[model samples]
Target chain A: MTRIGRRGAGLMAAAGLVAVVGVTVVRPQFSAAEAERPAQVSVDEVEELERAEQILIQRCIERAGFQYMIVPRFVDPVPFTFSYVVDDAGWADKHGYGAALRRRAEAKVDPNERYFRSLPPTRQEALATALNGPEPVGLTATLPGGQVVQHSDKGCQSEAQRELYGDLPTWYASTKVIQNLKGHRFGMVLGDPRYQAALPAWSECMRDRGYRFTSPDAARSEKLTQVVELRQAGAEARCAISTGLGALVRELDTSYDAQLREEHQSLLATRVDLQRRALPKARAL
Target chain B: MRFMKKAVAAGAILVAAMGGAVVSPTSASAAVTAPPPDGHLYAWLDINAGEYYHCRWVGNDDNWTNCTDWDGVARNMHDRASSVQNRGYTKEVNLYNDAGQRGAWRCLSRGEFWPDLRNVRFNRGSSETGYNYPMENRISSHLWVSSC
Candidate 1:
């Protein structure tokens, strides 16, 4: 072989070696960077919570006296109609730690502010819908019993509905559904109208746990303590409802989450083009 | 051998006259360009986020299992990545969650870009076949994200 041919072969090999080394080093770096970047929104849980909250809130709103909207993520609503009702009924409120709304309402908050103030969470949606919108309502009038009643002009439920669903008389309903496909048992219930209804009686129960209504018979107090006991029972029932809902919700979306997971993995499996526009700007640090 | 030498000499002369270029610059550049890594962004499933937690709780009786406590989620994710890498694929993974006091989970993967990839999944720790932790202790979608 000529000397030039051997030299040419050696030079070619050296160039190939440099190219391979450079490519190997550069490729992994790019791949690694691409691999680490995360998606903008991981929102499956948020969506699910919102769905569940919507269901419960709708159910609660449809009932007569609970004539109030949930303050998503807020501890309680301003002027707290529920609290005022409880205070008027004179039941002591109590809640576990966390947001201020977790506390029970004592004093009669102004009917106008009732829609705006914080109070104990009964339907238990304050945490779930926190990210969405704020509370929407205002107070109207003070009742003769010192309870501040939200006025009809304020767009709350009418007096008759409140009477039927609230202080007057109310019935609780519970529904149980066993998922056919997944064999999961879930239950939803309106155990206590106070938790589910905006009834003045329910609110009055919140204030004085032992407060009672004097029947026109005048000698007999309609034992408001029964309402407190009812509330405690309702809390227990709601807990069960939450658990059942959890199982059923999981079953309903199994394939969907699976698909999302697959889509995510596929995204991880392919090559990415880091366009100049998409590249992150280098931080000064 | 003499004919081969003559042919080689002729090729060399032609190459020298043509600036010794064996391939067009465009073709050479194209041949050397390495494929980019998959850049599709994937965020780690934020269990705190409503969608992920709801998916995990959909059917199983236990509503209280927390995805964050399940470190196996991360391990499973890494293992899945190994399978893909073994199959001659490229990727990146990351962890993410909503704003809260609890530390974010590490098992989920997020990517920047991806193409020709279809699906990737891993066990997120909760199982229909097995018992999960206590429900009373379990975090719910109704709980504040920060509490997680």
Candidate 2:
């Protein structure tokens, strides 16, 4: 998984690639069984929708009298796709923060310098406005903790989203609500009584293997040599499985997702519709 | 049982993928800063001496010397955050040099890490509003807003 920089507001994801195999090897839960597979949504659907949105964005550019080439930039960092979950141990271990994945993929990016250079500054500005929206007009959403994030959505991405979800402001607020909840969801699962009951045993298992952290996250946070992190990560993954953290977190995540779907039904319904809408477009493509 | 087998197999594939991809080595430490559990905003700060901290939340601190680690990034969190990891889902976070969202600032989209924000400045907004020089350790207060 590679994430394109969300820069210049108007520019699309222009660089990055994920091996098809990466998806198969992602998320321990999904990889293991076709039968006992817990409830989850396919990121594949999301990716397809993203591609569909790009088609509309390109049309927007053409209408503006500028040539727009489809830039199939992958936005999620390597080893996994999206920011939703980290059930994929391979991705989790290799990407930790997913920064390296971006670093590796960025070197291959070409911001269509040739096309942009062909235009004068005035036209360039127009192109940016056409692709993104008017500059200096951005939106801000404050988190529960009161930290505020200001972002520009005047671009093709924003346009695509609006076309799908109806309006920007309401969609933005609704989505942020779920996102803020997301920040706490995983921590909640790991801290749950069921998950907590397995902690001591998991810690013991790690300690027996010469690791000291009581929690998997702590062990993963250690800044060891890549080799050491990799080696320890393997043991940690096994420990998680043996100690039941793996099974428990997956179950909790699925339950939480279901609960969220019900709690935020209207907004989530819009999202589900967005995914379904992408399938026909995908087939046509 | 079959699921566990599949997970183990996936793990093997990952180990193989990571086998030859060697990253630069850092000194060993018992210190562990688990990334903030998924879903919240986070940034990675690396100090001058190769010491790095993966931080979850940063608050309003007027001065670095006046800060503490547990809540923000410890005291002296002022001008030392050389890098940042933006794991945000929707918003673009602005990194300012000075407290209360003052001084030179830079905005990063979600899932971006400026291994170095030392000399970076604000984009998207007018260039006239941002500092012309590189801003290191000058970030004071920041808020997540609609655009940077």
Candidate 3:
């Protein structure tokens, strides 16, 4: 596990400047400069980072005298809906619940899996070891729940992450903590009185539009014909906007996310710092 | 070849089906089941996929409290899995530490098998802070995702 060196600290200071600039231009509410303010990392940047890691993995495995396939990460055709309700009428009209897109995605076979299966037994075993490093024993992380998880620090995969992210242990811990925060944030948003108070209006709006659903999730989960599903989804999205459900959910979700970020500021800072530093390296790859 | 730690002990049971050679517990456990091909994710009651006590699922399951094992007998898999295997065709399998997919979790890539989950751990859960726990015998739910 690599410690955050002086170079890393310098990079973090630069990242802090960027965030401060963002706050100054975007949200004037906080006149004080918050060095730990979270920067919104774009999806494209994340994809680039993933592609870079795959490249590094491919190189590492090949150096170990094994053939490694660089599988491109799957990109969802439909955008993710983070809010409890779907607010984009256009998106709903085009892809109701994105069932068809999901099916299409499922049908798309992964080349990596196919290649691995085609290898002879001995070669397959060797390749697996090369890629994964035999066991999960080198790097350890204690999660927010206090569960200690470990990953192989010797694998080509681990090397690739270390190459880009700097410290594998810190990267693993911070990323896991950030990802798991979603569940709690979702639960908080669901239980919020403001969210609950707005739900009835959204439900009533949908009801008036010939749909009987108490929540957007209920509406989305109901099975219907393609044509009906499209129409219902359109109505749901419209109702979400009309009743202010979508906006409210988004606001609450963001608020909670910010609060969580504050609570785990140091971890978030480290993760964002690493990512920012890796961006140039990812682009170069 | 790096043989799975438990393959030696389970080799006798799998030899007939796997041609007297067991490379990994994934192939060993898979040899026990007939037909339906090998695309389902499996969870075992004992480490190294202990003798005939396992359940398989091809899709997402929110709860495994009363699921049937390989022998067609009813078994509770929730929070009772000591090992796991992902024989999935493409997707990665996510094993959650809590039911209803609400807790700490980890992803097992395609063809990856954990013969002994005692070495694994659920990264963390938002609400349950500061509690160190092993992943062994504590998986409550699962889902197949595109990536880890």
Candidate 4:
């Protein structure tokens, strides 16, 4: 299925290209199932929000008599990175370890970075302050780790987020907590007894396949030529699926993620609601 | 600033005595002797990598104050870093505003380098009423993990 799905509509509408005279608009095509899919914040929606944020930031910088270049966000070709194990044989066969994809991503030059570097030291400092604020003074979110973080409420970046999200401090707090939960969740998943119990079968499956790796993570870490790496990755994925390691990992991941979500339900709900409310504003921008 | 420069200079001489090459930070094409690149998370006392005074760790460090540089000299890097670089092989590095990887934190993806931490902020605060603080000279701990 195409990744854009129903969410493509938001991005298309936000493009505001329908009024451009004599322009051929290539619409994003998706299957019926995709169109009927449940509504969630898709990548396209996030991109739309980011686009709007850039616009707001540009305006803010311009208001401060500084030139601001709106750099397009870098989109990775292989979006889904297999952190725990390579469980998809098809993906492994096509893009083993995603080395080529990484190279392409690295090769892409960011004009905003170049422009910032080209400026004089004094101008660079001024531009940096204009974009990120002179100091992080306002808006703090206490994360789950019991640490306090602060950001500048007066900066263009903060101002843009405030305009889009409505409640800057809450949004900042919620998003930060949500983002930081991954590591904790992963730790929980990996430490689960069930996950440990399933590893032996997975290891045996790999051993039968002529790979001596004790775990999927070990197999993934071993560097080899493109040909060998692809073969090994494919074998690992096959073993993972055959031994039910893949399914178990997914289940544990979901379980741990749900627990984390439950722990921070209020924050997550607030963040989601804010983002949902910002959709129209983002599109309007 | 002058005192810091002098301190760094003195530290460099000590490092030189201990069989490490110290490169001037301002010298064009200055290549300081660094730790072996084995998926290390590096932080600098000054922006753009303070060649003379920097710390590299391959694993989680709960306290930056007790951490030593590649030259094996204690620099009390706690709350004194202005830049950071993540050369992690397959994981992202998390920088924390407080010790023991507590408090507000931010993730630095593999191969990502923040030459100036002034532009970065810890993701959250210790309390709902607390404010997000600037990352510059405020990082006290770090952890390397599978992902951010």
Candidate 5:
């Protein structure tokens, strides 16, 4: 109804809300169905332990790409949440010190998920075995309809999960659990009751390479402006930023980059200019 | 990587959300020097006149050009099989669908033509970037020249 600047208005998206009916008209019993729906099926005590170990192993592989265990962190740019995969070893080596980490969630898996408590040590071991070397193994959890959803410990990237489940919450938990365990066990630390023990070891590894580690939560917070600047200055800080609530970053993702290049060619040039100009001026310690 | 491809898909969805015509892939003809008086001479290559009108094409140079009709209203929304500079406005613009058949359409942006010298000289596609590509060829008839 209202207009703003020429192109800016065109680019703008409507934000303010108006009251609207819930989708009850389309799916009348939506809330009821949710209540009646079967909770996520928990695996057998034997299977739970294997899955946990598998999760750790997968994290190790993911961290190998980063040169060591790096935290998968969340980045937001409106519309979606993004997990920025960073190279921990590269950052530590380049910065010659660990960057300050923020606080992280104590539990990787959601407390309310069906299998959180049911994960037995044996199942955790099976998971570890599946993740240690190659090929993805499928684990099935039976749902309410006598239907089973097959989940792979390895083939689960953020995007894949998004496609399969469509619901953001499921994708978030499953992906974080998978990426977290793999990262911890393979490159940085082993999954143990003393898993938190790995934090100090991580600090030492980062310290040896020159990073200053702190709380994982702070590392994922809005305080990244300075760290981003350091990264742009070529420090490549080891981003152990935990995957805080996975949604996708709407604008900063690759899709936006291509669109800017194609539909809005000039903006591509502008972004390049901004990165070039601002990056060099950023201070790196 | 799959992440990058999905990102590209998301970008296209965004373009659809924004309502700007995504550039179609096709070959655009070169600019024709003289636009006939009766026929509307569309400026393809950016010029002072066309730039004044906020008309430009996106996508590969081959397929698309975002332009307005003679009156500065968006009339023909079509792929640039040949750019306006090459072939002046046809009486009836042809539209094509994915099946490559002519399709019915409606023009998107239509307002009274405001032919401003300042607006003409500095026409940037996206306001964020003030990029101006001058239209080389001029309409030989309507001479609004400034005697400096």
Candidate 6:
């Protein structure tokens, strides 16, 4: 692949993908909005629930006779949907996987961690109890493969969870599989022949732009110089789109999501009901 | 390795991709299962008696035994329980330290695996606010509650 120059910029703009001006890399609309999908709990929904949890935890801590400061929710420069797959060339061009977000998140929590550490062990235990309940107590389930996990209904932690998702243990089991399935989905995508086939092209696109990274993750490493990092990331993002990795994986994800929904239609129904009930309660926080 | 106070959901067999940069797990067929029977909130005591780990399930039988079951022929071991893992499919269970269900109670939410019973510290006072004390092995009686 020839090094992309003004020709590449003009070509991308002509295709309605991006517009590059000097050092500026333009982005297309986020693809998650490209389709109107069935309603499941969105990342925004989960984030809201989490923020409510933090508030409740803070309150619980205060009730335990210690002052607890609320930490800001860790913000990612990229949308939650985009985090799983760097399928957005525009996002990558502007922010290489938003690696700085990790540091930002850490900085946000440092004070909270410090304050927590300052408490005496007894106070610490009290705070933990107030927040988590009397350690985990509740249900133990065994899966067919000898893998067992437990869910606890104890503590303010569970209380906060219950506020968002009714029927806490059931909700947890149902919603939890969604996360597990997703991890599996990603693994599947990486293994698919088409995605594997496209990687070399993505790597070539990055290489043509003077970056020698073999993968987008490598090009997006935060350790690199900010200027060089963004440049490489931008190049990889454009390449990812040009190679059609974004659209391909998006299709795969949608398909898998549908299959899982069908397989667990019963659980999904409860999940939808719980999340709908939860949204308003979370907002009330 | 740091003590992950957080109970890890039984570890997934992780599949690494792109030279291990992108990591994801193959969906285990076992991740889904039918709900437990007896319909009562189920709680498990995780015991590591020396090198081996043992899990004991309690509170599902018609006459589930606990410290409060004074009329029972046998009492479920109390305080010997090291940690609790709750598998209550739908409801929350409360674990108590004092007999007759009248004392400090801990609510175990559903689908949560807490690796340690000694995880909570509370102050031993007369009311909601008190001095801090650890709650490991002190559970005696418990009741299912509406919420934790």
lDDT of each prediction vs. the true structure?
0.24, 0.49, 0.68, 0.66, 0.27, 0.50
Name the TM-score of chain A in model 4.
0.76
TM-scores, chain A, per candidate: 0.20, 0.61, 0.76, 0.76, 0.19, 0.67
Residue-by-residue lDDT tens digits, candidate 4, B51-139: 45778786789999987775667778899998776644335677888787766677875444455577566643322111256688889
Residue-level lDDT tens digits of model 1 in A233-275:
3432233233343233333245444443454443322211211
**Model 2, residue A105: what's the lDDT?**
58
Worst 10 residues of 4 chain A by lDDT: A21-30
Name the runs in model 6 displaced over 4 angstroms: A1-59, A68-72, A80-90, A110-114, A139-147, A163-166, A212-214, A217-227, A277-285, B1-148
User: For residues B40-61, what per-residue lDDT tens digits would candidate 3 score against the true structure?
Assistant: 6778887655455678876789
Stretches of candidate 1 off by over 4 Å are A1-21, A36-245, A250-285, B1-148
Give the best candidate by DockQ: 3
- Local lDDT at A56 for model 2: 78
Candidate 2 off by > 4 Å: A1-48, A62-67, A73-130, A135-153, A179-181, A273-285, B1-148
Q: Which segments of model 3 are wrong by more than 4 Å?
A: A1-48, A69-71, A276-285, B1-42, B46-90, B94-143
Can you tell me which runs of candidate 5 are displaced by over 4 Å?
A: A1-195, A204-212, A215-218, A226-285, B1-148
Q: For candidate 3, write residues A1-285 as lDDT tens digits.
A: 123355568668666866887745644433334544446567887888889999998999899786667777787676534336778899889877677777688677677666767877556656665666554445545445543433456667779989999888778668766866765577678778998788789989988999888777666544578898789889988998888888898889889988988898888878878887888777767
lDDT score for candidate 2 against the true structure: 0.49
lDDT of 5 by residue, B1-148 (tens): 2123432443454445447553221100011012111212233222212222323321112222344544445632332112122111111121122112212111111100111112121121111111121111211111110000
Residue A233 CA error for candidate 1 (Å)? 7.6
lDDT of 1 by residue, B1-148 (tens): 2123432443354445447446332222122111111111111222111011111111111112243211124211211111111000111122211112121221211111111011222111211111122111122221111110
Choose 1 or 4, whichever is better by TM-score: 4
Question: Ten residues in a row with the worst lDDT in model 1 chain A?
Answer: A171-180
Answer with 2 or 5, whichever has the higher DockQ: 2
Q: Which portions of model 4 show Cα errors greater than 4 Å? A: A1-45, A65-72, A79-81, A222-224, B2-106, B109-148
**Sort by TM-score, best first: what order?**
3, 4, 6, 2, 1, 5
Over B51-121, each residue of candidate 2 has an lDDT whose tens digit, in order, gives 33434443233444454432444545555565454433334566665565555455665533343344343
